[model samples]
Target: MTTIPMYDPLSPEMISDPYPAYARMLEERPIHWHPVMRAWVVVRHADCVRVLREHATFARDPGRTGEEIPDFRQNVQMMDPPEQTPLRQLLVGAMRSQDKDQLFQEAVAFLRGRLTAQEPGEPFDWMATLAAPFALHMSAALLGVPEPDDEAYAEISHGIALRMDAGLAPENIPQGDAARKRLNELGESWFPRPEGDDGLIANLIRRADKEFAGSHYIRNSAAMMFNASYGTIFAMVGNAAHLLATVPGLLPELSVPSHVATGVDELIRYDGPAQGTSRTAVTETEIQGTRIAAGDSVVTLLAAANRDPLVFKDPQDIKLDRRPNPHLGFGSGPHACFGSEFGKLSITAMIHALRDEGLRPCLAAEPTRRTTATVRSLDVLPVRLSR
Candidate 1:
């Protein structure tokens, strides 16, 4: 067996840019046990697909691996079917009730207002002013809840993101704990809500059956949906904006209405918000000739899988119209992202608004990235918009 290189997710370099390290791992150890993470790392596209799709062999809940997980982590994404199926259906049904065109128009108006507020020649922080607020607005619309204060939302979301890394970085536990507490409090306020309400939370509360009657189940699930919706769009738009500002030849392609949807998929495949997610082996499984015993932890490097050259030709380059794109940006199988359509609509709205306004963004200053491992986010993105 070839020796696996040390993989430290918290390393500053990895936090800033992990694709290089992921490439090396994919080239050498497609699937191997990592002593530090105490899990098998699966990097190749085919292998990662196998791990995500085969729910019978690989379970979403870490508890199956004999590791005790906090209750907050037990949202629908962490469950396996038959338990996962009905909850997913409920969430999906609630989401379908959202007005896609109306939401898109709302997003466009919101972005236009933000863009117009900034002077043409002056640089403004895109992430703080535009990306985050746009995401928050869309999230509130989807949940049928009033928009929360941006500062408070930022603090809570940051803590939750940090909490995700608590397993790998022990120092984040306290912040994660605080975030969890705040989230629980927030979830509580939404309850005793009328089932006749139009928001996604109300829909879930109304449709919840005896199995999901537990207070924690609905609350945590709603919170999960809100957070995931906010964070994904925030990161995605920021990443896309950065590319549109810096990458050559992208602006023209994406400006076309027909290409906007295709471009969104390309952006997700290129540098999606989620870096990776873990699954536990319920039964002994072999991936690419490597044997994984039951109860072993397996981490699928999703960002790496999306860029695997064997599946995506010219994987490093951005092809806005790339076809047969089977990217795992939203994952796959039983646990695929529940808000993918909504996410796509929100992202497409931003791009289309920019196109209509003839707004071309250029980087004003060097952008900084967040240090979190699980959610790849931008700390600050400064841009100067020109019409």
Candidate 2:
């Protein structure tokens, strides 16, 4: 057996750039048992794709096959095929209802407002000022959070994120607990909205059967909305902006819609915000002859899979024009990021906004990153708007 290399996804060095290590792992032990994370980290693109698509053997929540987790069952992402199929179909219908052109226009309108108001020579944090608000507004609309209650929406989102992502510190768990309570209460109000309503909250209400007649599904589903949709978008757009700003001569390509779309895909493919996710083996399984016993956890390193040399040509290089790009940035299979369309549109709008007037780093404060293991996010990014 080849000696599997050790790489801690939580370490600060990994936070800066986990790709080089991931590359090594993919080449040496694509199915290496990572001691630090205590799971077999699948680094190859083919293997990750299979793990995601093969929902039968690899269950999202191992508890589902054994003991039931009430909250986990409600989360569509944490569900398996036979159970999640119907619910996911319903969500697909709702997602299709959204007008992509309208979304693009809305994104442009919102981002242009922020960019126009920026101080020419000074640095401004893009995440708080633009990315957060843009994502918050869009998520609010999707979750059916009514206008004029920004505080409630914010609190609910923060609490949901803390609970789902384990972002809350031990001492801060109380705040998250309180926030979840608030979200449950808010669900009550949202669940009673008219049947004709289009927000995700209302949509979930309409789909609820006797078993799910209330906000039980709504509250948990909202977490999925935040994580896969709004939160992912917020992180990716911000990260993409920071990366794009550093690239020279790409501003012109942003003006073209085809290029913008492909650019967003490549940007996400190269350095997407999603760090990695884990799944549990339902029964015994083997990959490349490596045995994975039932109940063992397997972590899929998405960023690593996105850069597998076997799948991508010149894997290290970021080519916006890269075609046949089947990167697992949005993931794959049943639990793939369904909200990817909206995210792509949002990124395209960002590109166009920057194209109007080029952007440069402010040098006022260096960009900083959060110390998170499951996701990569920026703490602050300062950029100067240039015309």
Candidate 3:
């Protein structure tokens, strides 16, 4: 194992492609202290798995640090079991009960509409016109909520995504809070939700009493879900599309349904948006010979772990048909992403729709990435579609 420099997420090199840095960490410092994150950076696949799964040892609650909880840490995403379980069950059940076929059809139709408007051979910003609106439409359909105005939705999405950075950049706290407030306000309008099969909201409202005590919890949880759905799917779709456009032969290969069904997971494993997530050690624990003390923060570099050579064969290359692909594009354990199914549906829908429509999109220019560290998303992706 060869050691390199300390890991830094915000470095310019990391912003463009973090995998090389991740590869270095996996081989050299699988678990070590990170000054920027103020946590022990865990890069090995096995170690990241352990950190996420052993919730009793590594808790989600930031309060374990014995510091005042930050504003960004107040939501359902930051809670542990007993407190986290019921809300998790309700949201997960609602997502599961969703008519996946209906969602898929709707997604395909929405994407087709956007693709039809694209001028062939003329470059267009895919992130703005297609990915953002499509994400909003699908998430709105899932929640059974009226889609907010585009301007408002964009502002909120940007803010909430920035909030995740508060751990590293405290200046983001204010903007993150404002975005969360707006999302909550949006969630508030959905209720007093009528009980019916309308969407996830109705399902949540009907089961709210059993799941949690207050409307506040339900509202915040629902808001969190909507934000996650729109923002996460937007990032995932954009990232996947970039791969299709840039990676040789991937577009044609994944255009097939059978291949894409498995390939979507590969895309996520290659470049997932939720790059890193953290947990606080509740008690002293040892990982790969490194002792982590109670109250210390352990940041799992999920994107890095996904490409660990020990776990993934030819870890750097994308194998669309790769099986037994136990990648943690989504975090594992008690807090695994609740919207994982929806994400897969959206990506597959985009690919299948493009193939059926005879539209092949290729990158017209280099794509630009968002400035944030925690969430790896595209800011601009220029492409030209050809029939």
Worst 10 residues of 2 by lDDT: 163-172
TM-score of 3: 0.95
Which of candidates 2 and 3 is the stronger one according to lDDT? 3
The lDDT for every candidate, in the order shown, is 0.84, 0.72, 0.86
For each candidate in turn, the TM-score is 0.94, 0.88, 0.95
lDDT of candidate 1 at residue 374, scale 0 to 100:
83
Regions of model 3 farther than 4 Å from truth: 1-3, 67-73, 194-197, 210-214
lDDT of 2: 0.72
Order the candidate numbers by TM-score, best to worst.
3, 1, 2
Candidate 2: tens digits of C-alpha lDDT, residues 88-127: 7766666666667766777778878888888887778977
Clashing pairs in 1: none
lDDT tens per residue, model 1, 38-124: 889888989888888889899987666677867766677677888778878888888887778788888888988888888897999
